[model samples]
Target chain A: MSLLEVKDLKVRVDEREILHGLSLSVNPGEVHAIMGPNGSGKSTLSHVIAGKPGYEVTGGQILFRGEDLLEMDPNERAAKGVFLAFQYPVEIPGVTTWNFLHAALNAQRKARGEDEISSPAFLKKVREVAKSLNIPQDMLKRGVNVGFSGGEKKRNEILQMALFEPAVCILDEMDSGLDIDALRIAADGVNALRSPDRAMVVITHYQRLLNYIVPDVVHVMSKGRVVKSGGKELALELEESGYAQFEDAA
Target chain B: MNVVVAKTGTGRALGDAFAVARDRLPGKGAISDLRRQAFEAYERMGLPHRRIEDWKYTDLRALMREVLPLAPQPDATALDRAAGTAKAQAIEGVRRLVLVDGVFAPDLSDLAGLQKGLTIRPLRDVLEAGDALSGQAFTADSSNPMIALNAALATDGVVIEVANGTVLTQPLQIVHIASAAAPGAIVTRSLLRLGRDAVATLVESYLAADGATAYQAHDALVVAIGDDARLDHVRLVEDATGAFNISSATVSLGAHAHFNTFGMTTGAHVSRYQLTVAFAGEGSKVETNGVNLINGKQHADTTLLLDHAVPHCDSREIFRAVVDDRAHSVFQGRIIVRPHAQKTDAKMMTRALLLSDEAEADNKPELEIFADDVTCGHGATTGALDENLLFYMRARGLPEKEAQALLIQAFVGEAIETIASDTLREVAIAAARRWLEARA
Candidate 1:
């Protein structure tokens, strides 16, 4: 059985339908990539899955480990081991990254009836993870994404995902605005977290990120529905063909 | 002889009970005359209430409808002992000087460890009862009724003098403890003088032990700081229930001198703290920051007046209030730059957070600039906590109540962060946190 199953998921933004009967399923240990052109509803699918407010879910049935996912709030979904790397992350002032991540991780832990991570243990873990990702300790001390560069913001999102170690991770155009070095680091961070019991859905418009973090299955989404599905070679083919064929279908 | 004093709201019956005992005006004939004139000014104005635009949010007229009686002459020794170490423990690392019921408690205070050139004594003891600095800077006889009343009843006030070129490390604490044997009114006064190139820290606290229908008043003055002098002043009030508090401070700054003040009010059924400053020398700066955390049906009002009299002066004001239950919070701030005070930079900001639907917050920020070359602006904002931020925090696993408490503390912490003294900053932060814990 798939770790996350989405059947006939429909999403609307501002009373306008964005995702119409989109369906996909990811079993544990599998990395699925959703490649699409602009306005193909890739980011919308991620936000709808995360339960962000103002996104109307007209019709959808999302199951995580055989449990209903739409019934849970965004944070509850997060606590249930679902993480979404936002396409455009928010800047929260006066809330340091260390503090924010500490709260987020402990909150998830407490939700699962687990003991809170102590400050010392948490700080050690953060330092280790941040060091590996080349993120400075001072950056963690600063307000979350308040003054971070585009690449830094995306990298921080990946760092949070690694820290939380979610069961199902969604990267919504996580490679956008990232330089070559940052993209490599972000891809490495995501790849390091992949396990037999975890699933991931990477949504992107380009095939560059796929070269670093190769996906087992690649699907073409047009008009909120997956129109085509193939193996890893399909991404390279699309890159060479440029998405003009999918644009006509959309 | 039954003297019938005219009653206000609570009536002369209570007024006779709270009338101040033992009026000790200084023998400086000229100074006494000026005091009388100031008192007359207050009489003419007569306790500004909601009718006055500046005092609109603070209804002193409604609060003073009934006058409480005053206690008879105090027992100097008992009052002196009560003002000492017991009071210093409330706030740590403080050099204490206690004023009991508006009278200086000499035996209970400390003058040791004071750096060279700094003098701490009673205001009456300076220059055979009059200091040159107090004569000039502290001599404002405004049309403000509250200032006039404080001047008329001024008796025992501290005289703090910072010698030229000396910077004291610890804060010099002046504690004003008002004790009423009966339900009556009491007034207290204090002064500070920072000499050229001198630096010091001053903390003034007003507290009232269990009392019945008490009224307390305070009038304070701070003189010019010479070029390169630094002074940090903090005023706090914790009064009893059914008590009325009116406190005022007027400060003047000299060339290149800096004055920073922080005020926190947690008590007093109806408390008003008035802060006014005038910049006299060039390149002088002043920043006034205050936080008022009120609960129950308490009423807290903070009013400020900044006067730019000279050129090249900068002034900033940041005040925040948290009102819960049926409590009401008021902030009225005004910045005035005179015609000759060109190149004056001033900003005034006031924000209030209401925790309940019934709680109300009134804020007024004003700026009157005469110089076209200066940059002056004022803003006032009153709103409840952002629902999105609250939801975000709650989604992080903090209980709903705990998340709200954290947000409230962060909002007020912005103002408290301006306090330059780290120890004092910690004290202020802890105090604000305690307020949040109890109320939020």
Candidate 2:
């Protein structure tokens, strides 16, 4: 069975349809890239799958591990091994990154009927992951993403992904505001988390991100529907030809 | 033309009570005169009503229909009950000064550990001896009727004096426990004078004996910090659901002194904490912060007034309130820079979070700057929790209530972090967590 199956998924925001009968499937150990132009609903697909509110699932179904994904809450979906690296990370003042990550990890453990991690163990894990991501130790003491530069914020998203270690990961426009060095670091962090039993959906408008973290399959999204899907070469094809053809076809 | 008259039944009751008990009250000489003058002033003003600008959000006259009689002296049984309750609420490693039913309980307090330069005495004894410090403590004139009422009918409290250049390592905890098994009032007043170059930490906590009946408590603290002195004051009021707790503090800061105060309120059906900090000398620094967590039908109000009477003084006030259920939280902060207080820097910010549709918060931050060279500003914000932030946390695997608790903690953490002592900060945070747990 597939890890995630979306059959004719339709989503609407503000009474306007954003995802019109979009269908996709991802198997375990597969990294699929969904590339599209601006306003092509790439981010909407990732958000809807992550169970974010404000997007109405007007039609179709989402199955995660053969269970109805739409029936669960956002936190439940997260505990069920689904994660989304937000395009624009939210800044939560007064909530230190250390405290937030600890709470999130323990919450997931509690939801899974597992014992909570000890303080020393949790701190060690955080330090190891943070070091690998090149996140300053002092940054963990500050509020979550507060006063972080564009690059730092992006790197922080990857840090969360590494810490959560979800079964299905979704990256939405992760390369939008990152410099080349930051982009390479972020991609390295993502690449380090790939596993045989985990699946990932990388959503971006530019193909530059694909050069660092190669994908098994690439899907072209236009006007809320998947216009084309091919091997990794298709990313380079679209990068050279531009999205003009898909835009006109849609 | 239609004419409307303000109701003064609550005010009249209090005045009548004071008049009947004047002869038996403690104090003599100047202290007696001060009490008389204060009572007369209270009679002239009466209980503040909605019409008064300062008391607009909190109309004591309407909320408290009438005043209860003064609390009777605590019997042995009451004292036993208070002692048991104090054990559960006690903080480790602090010298405890327990007050049962408004009177100092020597047996329950630990005065044996008194430092060499520290002097502690019951207010009743101090007043009876006609000590000059008692008169000086209550000399500050204020327009608030509640302060006047506290002075007029105060039964007992403690007077603490630290000698010049004394630095105490342990904090002094002045715990006030209401052990009345009836609907009555307990009035207490304390005077704290820190000598020049002295450093101390004072914790004033208000609580009720377990399984105690409904009661009303009126408490006051008068603090004077000498030049170059540093004082960390923390006020924790967690009364029973059937209790009404009203407290007031008047503080004066000397030149080069550092005064930091943080108050937290999580209990009581109705509570109002009023604080007035005056910078009497140049180059002094003051920070006043508070957090209120109220639920059910609880009503909590925190009103602060910062008076920058001298130049080159800096002051900041931060207050946060979390209102749940049908509760109402009120924060009124006023920063006043006198005409000659040039180069005075003052800022105040008040934020309130409403958890339910029926919950309400009223935040009013005002700046009264008479000095042209002063930089003073005030800001107030009132709204429900941000849905986006909540979702962001929830999406990371926190349950709905856990996410909410985290956000609320963060909302009030800014104010709690201002506490200078590490242990006190943790205690405040633990109290907040308990409130959040009960709310969940």
Candidate 3:
């Protein structure tokens, strides 16, 4: 079975439909890039898949490993290996990043019927990952994303994605606020997580991120639906000729 | 041409109770005159009602219509039960002084590792011996009816003195345990004096024995910090099962003295903690912070007054309360910068979080600055937990309840961080976690 199968997915927010009959299938070991304009429903699709509240799934079926995904809560979906890297990471004051990550990891482990990771082991792993991601060691001691620069917030999101090691990862406009250097570091972190049994969906408007994390399949999303699906060259083609044609097609 | 008025039922009952028990009250000597004067003042004012501005949010006359009679002295059996309760709440590496039913239980207290220059005595003994300090401790001429009542009916407490230039390494814990099975009232008054250049840490806790219920307590602590001295005071009150607690702390700081106070109230049917800090000397500093966790129709109030009576003194107040399940939380903070108290810097901030639909929070922060060169400000915020923050945590694999608890913990952590001691901060955080767990 495919890693994820979204068949005729329909979503509404605030009495208005956002994702209109959007359907896509992601297979294991494949990378799919969903490129679209700002309001083309790329974020809505990722949030819906991640089970965020405030989005009503009007009419659709989301199958993760052939099980209905909508039946689970956000945390359950996370334990089931679905991760969404937030576009605008929240700043939770007084909650240190170290404590937040430790709690999240233990909660996921508990949900999977596993014992908690020892403190030393968890600390060592966090140090290794944070160092590789170039996240300041002092950042772990500070409040989560509080007083962080825009680039730092994006990197923090990537660091979380690396720690969770989800089976299906969705990057929701993760490259929007990052600079060139931060973009490379974030892409490197994403590249390090690629595995044969894991699938990733990188959603963005600009094609600059696609240059680093190459996708096997690229789809142009317009008006809440996939208007075109092609190979890696499609991203470059769209970068050259903006999304105007795709918007016209919708 | 004045009209005669009828006394309130609570006021009349309290007057009758005082008249019946005044003869057998514990204090004598100079304290007797003070007590008589305090009772007269209380009689004139009566129980504070909604009409009183300071007690607007907390109307004791409406909530506590009548006061319970004084609790009888605890017997040996009751003291033994109190020992068990003290053991449960005792923190490691601290000297514990147990008080059962408003009387000090020295047998239950551990006074072995007594550092030199430290003296501890029972308030009853000091009052009977006619100590001059007792008069000063019992004399607080405030309009607070509750404090006046405490001065009038205080049965027993502790008198602690730290000699000049003495710095104690360990903290002193005063544990007040209510073991009374019957519904009654307990009044205790404590006095703490730190000599010049002396430093100390004091932890005062109030807890009810297991299965105990429906008891009222009026407790007061008068603290005097001498020149160049420092004191860290922590007050923890957790009395479950229909307990009503009214506590007051009157602190005076001398020249260059430092005082930091943190109060945590997790359990009580109706609890009001009043704190008054007076700067008696120049260049003194004080930081007062507290957290209140209330649920299940509970009512908790934290009223604070920072009196900058001297020049070049600083004060900061941070208070947070979380109200859930129809509970009501109140925070009233007033910072008064008196005239001629130049260069006084004072700031107060109060924040409250309401969990349930019926949960309510009332926050009033006021600043009265009479000096032209002082910087004084006050702010109050009342709202529910941010949904975005909660969803962010839940999306990161935390369950909904855990996410909410984490946010609430972070919210209250601002006030808890004011505690200077690492061990005490951990104890406070642990208590907060337990409150959150019970709430969940």
Candidate 4:
């Protein structure tokens, strides 16, 4: 059985149907890339799976470890080991990054009936992780994502992902507005999280990100549905011949 | 033919009380004459109502139907209760002066080891026979009825004078604690003067002991900064939930003087604070910041008047209010640049965050620039929490309540951070956090 399954998923936002009928399945340890043009419902899929509000699920079902995923709140779903790397990390002034990470960790722990991490131990863990990602200690002291450059914001998201260590990871437009060096750092962070029991979904409009973190399977999404699915070579083909053929075919 | 004017309930109560207590009060000659004039003015203008522009949002005539009886001088029991409350709010590394029931309580205060060139005297003592400075007239805003009321009834407060070219090593704290034993109306007044090239820090706190509710408090302050002098002032008020607070401050700056003041209001059923700051000489600067956190049907109002009469002066201000659960908050700030005040720079911003649909917030920022070469701007904003920021916090596993509390703290922290003292900043932050936790 697959670790995650989406069967005939349909969603509506603002009185308009964005996902008519979309279905996909992912097994453990597999990296799947969903590529599409703008307004093709790629982001809608990721947001709905993450339990973000304002998306009305009109039809279909989502199963995570055979449990209903839509029935949980955003925080509950997060405690159940689902994480999404946001495209634009929010700038929360007056909330230090260290406090944010600590609260998130402890809240998830409390939701799972686990004990909280001690201050000293939590401090040590955050320093180790931040150092591994080349995040300065001063950045941890500053407000979350406030006054951060493009590269720093993306790196912060990756830092969160590294700390959460969720079972299902979704990267939503992680490459947008990123310089080459920033993209490499973000991709390297994502690549380091791959595990045998974890499933990953990478959503993007271009194939440039796939060059660094190679995907096991590539799926073509158009008009809120998966139009085609093929091996890794499909990503290379789409990169060479722009998405015009796929858009026309769909 | 005759015309009859009926007095308001509070005005009648205060007038009758003053008529009976006049002869027994402190000062005799000059102070007695001044008090009578203030009382006559207050009688002419009964409790301010919605008709007054400055008192439009806060109508004391309706809110305060009748004034409580005047609080008697602090007895032994009242002094004991005041000691605990004053200690609870005291910060380390500061000289403390305590006032209980509008009377100075030397037993509960720290008076030994005074700083060099510092002279501390009770306002009552000064008013009796000491310095003519105590009887000096206030740079009064005759338009404010609260000022008149306070001047008529102020009982006792601290008066400190810093000598020329002297710098105090530590801050001085004036802790005003209303005794629960006598939960009644009280008025207090204080004064501070910074001589030329002198520097000082002052912290004023207003609080109440346990079960110290159903009381009314009116406080007034006068500040004078001489040439090249600098002063840091931090004021915090966390009164009981059933108390009413009305206070005012008048400040003037001399040549090249510097004045920075930050205030926080987090308690009381209803409160109105009026502040006026004027630049009297060239090359002076002033910065003022304030935050108000009110919930559960509480009402808080803050009014500021900035006068730039001299050239080459700067003024900056930022104020914020967090309203929740049917509470109402108001902020009125006005900046005036005189016709000849060239090279004046002034900017002011006021913001309010409404946590519930029924919560109300009114923010008005006005700028009057008579000089063409001056730069002046003002802005006002009222909004709820950002849905995007909330989602981002919840997505990271914080519960709805925690996320909201975090956002509210961040909103008010922007103004609290403007406080220059780390210890004072922490005091403000902790008070704000307690307000949030009570909501939860």
Candidate 5:
């Protein structure tokens, strides 16, 4: 059985339909890359699956381990192991990164009836993860994402991803604002978390990031639905030929 | 056509109450004349209504349903109750000066190991001596009637004088505790004087003893910062929901003086803080920050008149309010730069967060700059919590209420973080967190 399944998902935002009959399946230990042009509803799909408000799933069945995912709240979905690396992480002024991370981790643990992580232990885990991501310890002391460079913001998202250790990861435009070195570092962090029991959905517009974190399958998305699914080489083809033919073909 | 101005019932009650208790009031001689003059000022002004620009948002005439008679001085039982409060609210490493029912209680205060160059006296003594400084704050610097009312009815308060060139590491805390059980009003006037080149930290708190319900408070603080002196003042006020308080603060800064202050209020049914600050000498800087966490039909208003009367003076004011559950918050910030006050720098910003649809926030920020070379700017923003931020937090597994508390904390933390003292900042943050927890 697939670890995650989306069957004929249709989503509307503000009375306007964005995703129509989008379907996909992901097994354990797999990485699926969804390539699309701007306004292809990639982010909408990620947000809808994460249970963010304002996205009305008009017609869809999202199953996580055969459980109905749409019925849960965003926090419940998060506690059940779903994480989204935001394209643009919102800056929460006056809230230090360490405090936000600790709260988030403990809240999830509490929701699952597990004991909270002690402050010292949480600090140790954060330091280990932050060190691996080259995130400065001072950044943890500063307000979350406040005054952070674009690269720093993306890396901070990766740090959260590492800390949360979600079973399914959705990387949305992770390479948009990162420099090559920063992108490599972020991709390395993602690679380290790609365990046999974990799955990932990489949503990006360009084929640039697929080079660093190779995808097992690449799906071409146009309008709101996936147009083609093939092996990883499909990304190189699209990169060489550009998305114009796909837009016209659809 | 003939027009007559009628006084409100509350106004009439206050006047009749004053007439009945005038002989029982503190001070005599010249102080007696000052009290009569101040009360006359209050009588002439009547009750502040919406027509008055200063009271536009607060409509004191309508909100003040009735005026309670002055509370009696604390008896033995009252002192025993107040000692526990003073002990509970005590900050470690700080000396406390206690006032029970607006009367100074030395037994509850920490005056055993008095530091050198620091002198503390009850304001009754200064009022009895007819000290010129005691009457300064009640004058025309503020047209608000409450200042005059405080002057006329005040029973007692603390007066702290720091000698010139004296530096004290330990902070001095003045705890104004309303201890009378029956519903009544409390009046106090505290004064802090910093001599030339002196440095100190002052913390004043307004508290109510257990069972003290439906009381009214009229308190004032007059501050004088001398040349090259530095003062960091923190004012924290928390009372029962049935309480009503009107507090005023007037500050004058001398040449190159530095005055940094932070105020937080999370209590009372109707509370107003009228602050008047003036830079009397050049090259002085003042930083004023405040937060108001109001809920459940509470109303909090902060009116600031910051005068940049001298050249090369810099002032910054940041105020925030979080209104929930039909509560209302008001902020009136006015910065004035005189014609010759060139090179003056001033900035004021106020933000309000409305947590419920029924809540209201009024932000009126004005700048009157006559000096051409001065740089001045003011901004006011009233908004609800950012839905995107909430979604972001919830997506990361923080529950709804926790996410909201965190955001509100962050919002108020911007203003709280300006406190220079670690201890005071922690106190402000902890109070804010408790306010959040109660909100949930």
Candidate 6:
């Protein structure tokens, strides 16, 4: 069975169906990139697959490792190794980064029937991971993304993804607000988490991030569903030619 | 016994309702004179009815029908039993001085080996000498009728004196336990004096047992901060749901003194806490922060008046209220900058989060500035929780209930985080948690 599967997913937001019967499947160790213009349901797909409420799935199933991901809560799906790096990471004031990450990690661990990592061990591992991502140590003590710059917030998203190392990680516009330096750092952090047992779905508007991430499959989305799927060259072709052809075809 | 209901010249009831209780008060001399002066002030000012602008939210006459005697002596069994409660145990590490029914409970208190620069004594114990206090006499002025009542009827209260150049690590906890089985009002007057360059934290708690109706408590706290001194005061009010609590705290800050007051209000059917801060010296700073969670049909009023009397003084007041059910919460904060009070920086903000359609919060933030060189502003906002934030959290897979709780916790956490001490922060958070858990 495919490690990550979305079968005929239909997500409606505010009575407007944003994701209409979209289906995709990815094997373990495969990196898939979904690129499209604005309002192309690129972000909706990632959010729906992550079990976000309000986006009703009128007809679909999201399977993670053969388990129905949509049936679980967001945190439960997270415990089931499904993670979505939000396009606009929510700023949780008064909740320290260290505290939030610890809670999230331990929640997943508990779901797997594993003992929580000790504070010292968690700190040590978090420090190492944060250092590798070039995230300053003081940021760990501050409120979660409360006053973070756009670039810093993007790096923080990748930092969290690296820390959790979920089986099916979806990065929705993780490269949207980042500079070249921050983009490289974020991509590198994501690349470091790429393992044989894990899969990733990168959602973005531009194909520039595909240069470093090097996805195995590239899908072009327009009007709530994937219109075309191809190899990594598809991203380059779409970047050079734009979504003009897809828009006209639809 | 008829509960004299004579209408006075000002459309208020003026009678000898408290005369018998006043005559029954023990002790004599200057302390008695203080009580008489307070009684006279009460006779003139009387119990604040709806006419008084400050007491508009909590009409005293409507709740307290007649004069109630001040409760004398602590119920050893009751205090002993409450000692085992969860909230009592939370203050184990604090230097506690317990007062039951307005009378000090020495047996239940731990005053041994008190901080080097600190002294805790009862009001009667130090009432022998007029010069015992370095500051002005504890007289009840017309500015506060409740203070007048408390001064007239106060049996006992905690007196704190912090010596110069000393910083106390632990907070001095004053627990005022009200078991108003008696038919009289309970009045408590506390005076806090912080010397030059001294630092201290004072935590006060007002708790009442069940079945104590027609209860009237007039509590007053007068804090005089010396030059360069720092004081942090936290007051937690958890009275009986039927009790009527009207309390006032007047804080006077000297040059370079820093004063911070954080209050948590939850109980009492009609309760009001008035805070008046005067920057009497240059470069003084005053910060007042409070949060009130009123549920059921409870009415809570938190009013503050900050007077920047001197130049180069800064004052900040932040008050928030969360009203649920049919409860009502009122926050009236006024910051006044006097003429020639140059370089005065003052800010006041009150935000209310209404949890139900029937619940209401009245926020009145006013700034009166007469000085050109001062910066003062006041703002108030009352609304329900953000629907967008709730939806966002729910979209993240959190149940709607969990999402609402998270958003609310975050909203109130802003006020809780302003607490300087970690222990106090935890205590406040725990109080908020208890409030949420009861409803959830």
Best by TM-score: 3
Model 1 residue B395 CA deviation in Å: 5.8
Tens-digit lDDT string for candidate 3 (A1-250): 9999999999999999999999999999999999999899999999999888899999989999999999999999998999998889999998999999999999999999999998999999999999998998999999999999988898898898889889999988878888999889889989998999999999998999999999999999999999999999999999999999999999
Per-candidate count of clashing residue pairs (backbone under 3 Å): 14, 0, 0, 0, 0, 4
Candidate 4 C-alpha lDDT tens digits along A127-222: 988888889999999999999998899889889888887889888999999989999988898888888988889998889999988899999998
Residue-level lDDT tens digits of model 2 in B198-283:
99999999889977657888899999999999999999989999788878988999999999999999988888988889999999
Every candidate's chain B TM-score: 0.89, 0.96, 0.97, 0.97, 0.96, 0.92
Candidate 5: Cα lDDT at B354? 93
Clashing pairs in 4: none
Per-residue alpha-carbon lDDT of model 6 for B1-440, expressed as tens digits? 34454555432322354565666553466667767776776766666777888777767767554545566555666666545432554564688887777777777677898879888887656654444551243744555777777777777677888899989988888887776565446777778899999999889887775555557777888888999999988888878777878888888899999998899988777888888898899998888998998889888988888888889998887788888999999898888889989999998888899989999898888788889997888888999977655443443334455555655677778777778888988988888878777777
**Residue A27, candidate 1: alpha-carbon lDDT:** 92
For candidate 6, the TM-score is 0.86
lDDT tens per residue, model 3, B1-440: 55354677777787888888787676676678788888877877777889999999999988877778888889998998998999888899889988898888989998776899999988988888888877877868557789998999998899999999999999999888999999889999999999999999999998999877889989999999999999999989888649999989999999999999999999889999999999999999999999998889899999998899999999998999999899999998888999999999898889999998999999988888888999888888889889888878888899999999989999999999999999999999999999989877
Please provide, for model 1 over A16-82, each residue's C-alpha lDDT reduced to its tens digit, 9 standing for 90 to 100. 9999999999998999999999988998888777766678889979998888988987677888888
Of the true interface contacts, the fraction found in model 4 is 0.69
Q: Assign candidate 5 its CAPRI class.
A: high
lDDT of 1 by residue, B332-430 (tens): 888898999999989888889888899998888878888788999888888887765655454444555656776677678778889988888888888
**After best superposition, candidate 6 residue A202: deviation in angstroms?**
1.7
Full ranking by DockQ: 3, 5, 2, 4, 1, 6
**lDDT per residue (tens digit) for residues A75-194 in model 2:** 999999999999999999988999999999999999999999988999999999999999999999999999999889988988988888999999998898899998999999999999
Deviating ranges (above 4 Å) for candidate 2 = B1-16, B140-142
Question: RMSD of candidate 1 to the true fold?
Answer: 5.0
- In Å, residue A240's CA in model 2 sits off its true spot by 3.0
Q: What is the TM-score of chain B in candidate 2?
A: 0.96
Give each prediction's root-mean-square deviation over alpha carbons: 5.0, 2.6, 1.6, 2.3, 2.3, 4.3
User: Per-candidate TM vs. native?
Assistant: 0.82, 0.95, 0.97, 0.95, 0.95, 0.86
- Pairs in clash, predicted candidate 2: none
| Candidate 4 docking classification | medium
Clash-forming residue pairs, model 5: none
**Candidate 3 lDDT for residue B129:** 84
